[model samples]
Target: MNASDSPRPSALDWLVEAARVRDAEGLHRTLAPRRADDGVLNLASNDYLGLSTDPRVIAGAIEAVQTWGAGATASRLVTGTTALHAALERELAEFLGTASALVFSSGYLANVGVITALMGRGDLIVSDGGAHASLIDGCRLSRARVVVVDRGDHEAVRTALRERTEDRAMVVTDSVYSIDGAVAPVAELYAAAREHGALIVVDEAHALGVRGRGGRGVVDELGLSGAVDLIVTAVLSKSFGSQGGLVAGPTTLRDHLVDRARSFIFDTGLAPAAVGAARAALGVLRAEPDLCDRVRENARRLATACGAETPSAAVVSLIIGEPAAALEVARRCLADGVAVGCFRPPSVPPGTSRIRLTVRADLGAKELDRVAAVVTRARTAVAATDAVRR
Candidate 1:
């Protein structure tokens, strides 16, 4: 038979087959609509401070909509920049004790914009091997010579920076890893960066609004705030319980990103409502620093109940091994009156698939008890199911 005589599969057929493989592994994902008044205990969301549904936050969003008319209209450099945006930037910088801050449409964009804007073909980026997807993509897009060190391996990062042929180097890490919830050795990493004369960028997406003084984040907690050379990126959606992101650093860094970062330069600005809500959320944070302690306490309770390590923040992981098993446990928890996160590979390494639980500051004893019970029950059920299959 001639090679040209063979038929090729349709694109839809290829997709269907790929989906079948995922389904077989219980890795298929679907969107489920969640209601505001569902009354279900939420241990799945990233609202560490439980400020999302606060009356004040809602009021702030409403006020912003009324005053600014919803959209930002254009890019920041265009007509998109607003007084609210400026205010949020100023306040966030002051809160984190950074010299300046620049807002972006999302955290991913902030990482991409900051990294790409600062580095290029001749520059080097030594990223943590387990960095968020956004940081990885930024490193790839920056056209920089990229090196990945083991997560929190300060010595490896130092060596990479020192050995790099590039004149400029940047070391990137998460203040707290998104998956395992492990806190990064930020202080040591910063020390390495300083020794090697490399810039350090810490993504505080999972750290902000959970750790530090009044949720200022790990940077401030380490007393490294106002370190002009250290750059920090954070999301407003998680702990702030709003939308958008920010890159906080020195004035020159912010100016460089504004001028050269395509993600910031070309994208439409963040909506007015999100800006107002985040700003108001900061007010809530300042008024109630105890909420940080509350969330950490909740996280510890959940972690202790699950036999996991003492949590560094509000996130805890329950490793279930298989994607199907993890999914089953998450569904079981939801059925048992609680919602939890299910992570699968490449979201997590194979054989380490698990459900990530974010213990909100508002979760009470009743909620915590239910979560703990469901998890234990789910594990037993999963073991039984596996035994039957075997």
Candidate 2:
């Protein structure tokens, strides 16, 4: 057929087809913003300390806006760097016991920056199989030879490192696995990396405000302060109850990142309000280190109540083993005025559908009891549905 005679699919056609595929698999995703006064109990968010709505944090953001304006007008390389950013960096480095720190717009960008900047085409990157999506993306973007070891396998990491033919090697892992809420064997992995002359990068997203002294993170908790070659990233939106991310390492490494990391050089700097709120949150953490104990206690309590019936950690994931059932349970919890997370195929490994509930320090006894009741009810409903299907 002639070029003019041939039918061409419109640009929107692909989107429609994609939506249809998602609908068929019940995998379609949608965003529903929560109202400021929503009465629903939240067990889905990553705000472990529940400081997102704290008066101090809000006041800090307000003060920052008044002093430094709303948005960063340009990238950090241009006009985005402010006194607040510098202060946050300094305070963060001191808190984490790192030699230097570089703030990024988000945790995802921080990972992208670290991995790609440090490892090039000839280098090798050995990562945990269960590392966060951001780290996986960073490895792909780095153009490095990426090898994913078994989840929490220190020996596999060592083997991978030993087998590496590249001149430079790096090992990456999360201190806490986001989905299962299981902690990684960071000390063993670090030792293995050291033995092989490979640098270690730990993402302490979930461990930052939940582990270590004054929530200094897993590195501090393990007494590996300033020992690991590099610690890549964390989301301020989580425990900090703000926005932005950070990379902490040696002064020379950070200086190299500032010059080479594309994500830091090209992206806009963190907004003043986020920096201020994070700073305030860090100050609060320093003052009330007991917040860490409360969060840990809440998690342990939930895990104990669930017993061997549910998966562990601050994140108590109830496996349904079926996507539709998991979704239904999540819906039931929501209808009962408790919001919990539903993880299916793409998010979880295939066939590991689960309802992931994250515990927070702000969850009072009454709220915890309510959540327990709702989850039990949801579980009963799923069991009944399964029985009927059989």
Candidate 3:
């Protein structure tokens, strides 16, 4: 028989089935690119500080491109490390009050690199159930025995640590949950890990530009910055308005990661433009500490508009319960010239699909009022439709 006529399954059949399943479950996703002047009131992006289009940030990127070109030409171990990278690292460490810092091309790489380098086979990893996907992926890749405790369950974390059979263990969590914007019990978790001789890794992706003093992040806010057992992974993309990630901790840890973290050794360094942009954003954060306060206040107002609890950070989540309903609400808001995040299964758990709203420091009161009106109308319309269907 000819190969094309054989009855064997095509290699792509599984992917087609997967797509069908996603569509059936209302989980199919597609990219929606925004035009430069879409005029949409964007409350969906993670630009908490609103520095992405700041003049200083733009100039920094331009300067970097002019000086270092468009990309980090090679892997860091070869020739990608530039002066901008070094300066950004030093400044990040200083801002976070850590001894040293290591930069990666992305936050996912930073989390995976640090976790896999620190914990290996036979080691234990106690992770928060709601930790970011990067942290979860890192735990899976570590080849360590993993225990996922309920979010904010400090007691469970302690129990896992106490019951651990592995000699070396690490506890992982996000400082601010990406879905509901809940702040982790960082201090309690830190104490538990310290008492149990376990290292703690905190991903501060959402907390950096919105929480803590001058946006130093939750670890610094909680006074755990230089704790010997603490390590921090942060994304520059969200808070810094750039494209990169960092691992900040002890100099010893930095040294070890440089030697042992495969992601660092093999991945190209962050482009000079990102490094410069992040640095400029950091400077803006420091210069205008009020940006932190402004963002949280804006988030509080947004949450109040939707009747959600006030957020500890810049994200305000309104649970919509069903993926289709959540998508419908988001669609209605977009149609009204407001953009919002519609988070469904996998991004959130079943029955907790939600409209996730992020606030920027520069969001004006008038814009927020409009957002409140649009979101309220959307929710009301969806509910009315649901009631009729029922």
Candidate 4:
């Protein structure tokens, strides 16, 4: 081997360096899969309505699998469009009060498709600083000039909208932030966008089955259904307990995305089983509206017991400051037979490491008490470790 080849580092060396940095900073994360037979108290999952394991939902999935087999088999533009896909789109549109709706394989793909298809070079996108990473990546792909405004600053959004040079502009934000569970001022934001002739896009990933009357999401909650200009996108993975995404909007916009959105046009359509499961979940939501309230109450109880502020939605994150401490707290809770989420930098905004907890309608009072006790012990342990270091 040549001397240069022996001394020089490979491209994979950069990955090793990154891993080393993460290890030193306590930012490294790994997945620990739970066995199907293992029984543990779960406050970590996004199944807010607890529909993933519901009998009706499972039955629907089974039926679909029996009829349609496994995969969609092709892209929707080609041979993948099925009757189930059409039915799900129609039902979602009717439920959300939109003129039309289109489904994507995942929420991430839906965001990428919408942003890239609607906006282009010379277009302007005014996004909230707290918008999810998918939205941020979509902006990058759109080749639009992205102006990130302060979180929930309506007046600042208005000013930016008014000052935009591009004839095409869009305002994007989440209805409920996934990390802190804070509700966005959607009514004010949409009004500002309308005044400036800009389209508004709201991602209701966390709000779909957790907000509004009958869980129709923020638009329905605010009674701004057809009045909002552009569209709404959401994940089926959360409260819907399925694996897909959908964009609800005017028929013209839906058609535009169908034709131009690379994510939709190129990617395989959602599985038939997922479509069926989501439809079943929607039916369940219609029959039992109080499930939403129960999830909200569970969230309130946990936050109250922890002496933390009650989250505005189903996600209640206890901000633990430092990353190492947050991880330690999560570990202790796991050891205590409680499974909770630990979110650190990159997943959350810088300096806001937290143990993010999602409340489920299925969690009873006894379960809540156990969770509270474990969290209390975890918090005390973290505090004592910090005191020792000082």
- Collision pairs in model 2: none
Q: Candidate 1: misplaced stretches above 4 Å?
A: 1-13
Q: Residue 195: error of model 1 in Å?
A: 0.9
Pairs clashing in candidate 4? none
Q: Write the per-residue lDDT of candidate 3 for residues 272-346, one digit (tens) a residue.
A: 999989989999998998899999999998888878898999998999889999999999999999999999988
Q: Which scores better on TM-score, 1 or 4?
A: 4
Question: TM-score, each model?
Answer: 0.96, 0.96, 0.98, 0.98
| Candidate 4 runs further than 4 Å off | 1-8
Alpha carbon deviation, residue 151, candidate 4 (Å): 0.6
lDDT (C-alpha, whole model) for all candidates: 0.92, 0.87, 0.93, 0.91
Give the lDDT ranking, best first.
3, 1, 4, 2
Q: List the residue pairs that clash in candidate 1.
A: none
- Please provide, for model 4 over 1-390, each residue's C-alpha lDDT reduced to its tens digit, 9 standing for 90 to 100: 878768766768789889999988889989798977677888899999999999999898988889998989999998889999999999999989898999999999999899999999999999987798899899999999999999888798999989888998999999998888999999999998999999989999999989898888887899977665858999999898889989998999899998899999999989999999999999999899988888889999999988889888898889898899899999999998989999999887667899988899889999998999999999998999899999
Note the residue pairs that clash in candidate 3. none
Model 2 RMSD to the real structure? 1.8
Runs in model 2 deviating more than 4 A are 1-7, 308-313
- Provide the clashing-pair count of each candidate structure: 0, 0, 0, 0
Which predicted model would earn the best lDDT?
A: 3
